[model samples]
Target: MNQDRILLEETFYVLTKKNSVFRVRLTRKGLSLIKESDNQEKKQTIPTRDIIGCKCLRSRKSTTSCSCQSLPRGSLKVVEENSGEQDENDISAYLYIYAYILQNTKSGSCKRERTIITLRFRSFDKYEDNNKEAKRWRNTIKQLIKGEQAQNETPDTPIMHKINEQRKLLVLCNPKSGPGRGKAIFQDKVVPILQEAEIPYDLHITKHANYAREFVRTCNIYQWSGIVL
Candidate 1:
């Protein structure tokens, strides 16, 4: 009895960087990317275990307005030419998926290669509406990733993907923590650990004394998932 259910599915055009169109779907197992052009269909599946992290980003601004017309199907050259031509009025949300896949090296060994899949979702009249959809997908993907990790760590642990907040971590770094080694400590020690754990954090360097304290006092703690000092 194969009981894998499709959680979410959407057909999106114009992958920002790659400029390819795809219909993406999510299941409990993995993400399926399906591309079809000129009656030829292709599919690539990224196992949930390979995906490290995913993030949703809002576009800055575009001078040229973007519209989905007859996309020159399978033509990379045309796609690249018009990729950056987006309208300032377009309120689009971008979703970035990070995964590591094995690649054959010239040295006759396999190496883990990081690939980022950027998805641009838009076409709605309202920005909020588009962002909401993007966030929904982000939340689902994040929870699935976390739930798998939790299961691996403890077989008997109860996994709750619904409760994990997709909030940025506020990191306060002291430049003088070790008289001069604070930067090194953060880069060499803290960063690698955070990356491996797949925690998204925003870094802030304290310049004057009590800077972090004063900032936290006035800043909204609700904006952050957690604070790290």
Candidate 2:
């Protein structure tokens, strides 16, 4: 199964060169910039395969700006601000730049172009602390991207076996016990959560007093990772 695990997440107030501020969610998938007042929700999904490089920059200067000329269609123009009265609250001394290539379909043909996205988190206190946090995030993301690239390159290689976090569970339900709501409880509450977590499970209702013990004794224990009674 191809799954993109979330390596990290951070909420940052992103400032554009245009002087507009947005609450952005930075994740392994990409950035989600939300502006409630303007009803703007911009999302940038950069696949690990697309990421080419990442870097962190610290500036002693008061102003910081970023631009992207070859961004994909529907990509938000988030980093454009004309020189104007700087807001006192706009305090970002460090910038994290991520470089990647986006594939766009133009006239039924696929085209690839390089794009750059810059983001900075709000720092209420010291500028040095902000720079350090930005650098940490930059390094972490770069390492994850590099690992993804390596995994892709060695697709045929045998992956190291690891314990599954979401393992198959055998749920033993005594439907006739406990107010006779076991079935209802599993159906109404438990099933939805299991489905949400993508957990595989098997439900077995007890038919008699000794049914559970007998089933366990004869059942193929190897098939189930764990039992939940």
Candidate 3:
């Protein structure tokens, strides 16, 4: 199997003397052998249950914090240095990290669709554990941003206020980003919040790279005050 495209718990089938039989194996890379022989060519689907075990371990959500996940480490490190310490416990600190991450990505320039945020913290003792910390921060930030703040809190309790935005939104999804889970994240998580808030927004699914740019050019910027990538 090719090392580039293997997924965990992926399977493939093989033919035998008596009849065609299903041979299952787990591939962590989501990869499976596509049999293409002179005698026969066919497509086989591997069910998650069929996998007795996986060759590759599932990636933790904290992977987003790693330098290798999408952007370079040095770049993130430089941004972190500029922002300050990568403190997971501090809300402001995590927000700065989130801003830094977005800055490194090419799509950071997309207008003010919403407050782009990142949260970081310590993970396991051995590893840097940025991803784990980032996720924890993400949850906390979302709760605050979505009007979960207490109205009658004392000075001691932190206040969570909504940041007013200036425009409608169109979220352009990149399937490749976040290991093909970007779209799912938007659908399952982002969409509901936008709807609950009565925020005017649309979802555009892209099949290839650079589709967002093309879509943006054709789209009427006036209709949507903001664009999220």
lDDT of 1 by residue, 1-229 (tens): 1215677889876464367779988876788889888999898878877887776665444333554443343322212113464333546776778888888999999987776677778868776788778788877787677763321133454554543458879999998998778878999877865774468888999999999999999989888888999
Predict model 3's lDDT versus the native.
0.41
lDDT of 2 by residue, 1-229 (tens): 2234444456654544233455554444554555555565655565655655555543322343533233344333222122343233334544544444556575777665655556665564754576577766666555445443222223563343443545588999999866899889888867855553346898999998988889999979668878877
Tens digits of per-residue lDDT for model 3, 1-229? 2323222221221211122232322232221334446878654433322222111111222324543344332233312422343423222212221111112337656332222212122234422354444344333334333434322223455444554455678788887777979888888877755654446777788888788889889878777757888
- TM-score between candidate 1 and the true structure: 0.57
Candidate 2: deviation at residue 107, Å? 3.3
Q: Which ten residues in a row have the lowest lDDT in candidate 1?
A: 73-82
Clashing pairs in 2: 17-81, 18-80, 18-81
Once model 2 is optimally superposed onto the true structure by TM-score, how far is the C-alpha of residue 136 displaced, in angstroms? Answer: 1.8
Model 2 stretches with alpha carbons more than 4 Å out:
1-5, 15-19, 26-28, 31-40, 60-91, 148-229
On TM-score, the leading prediction is 1
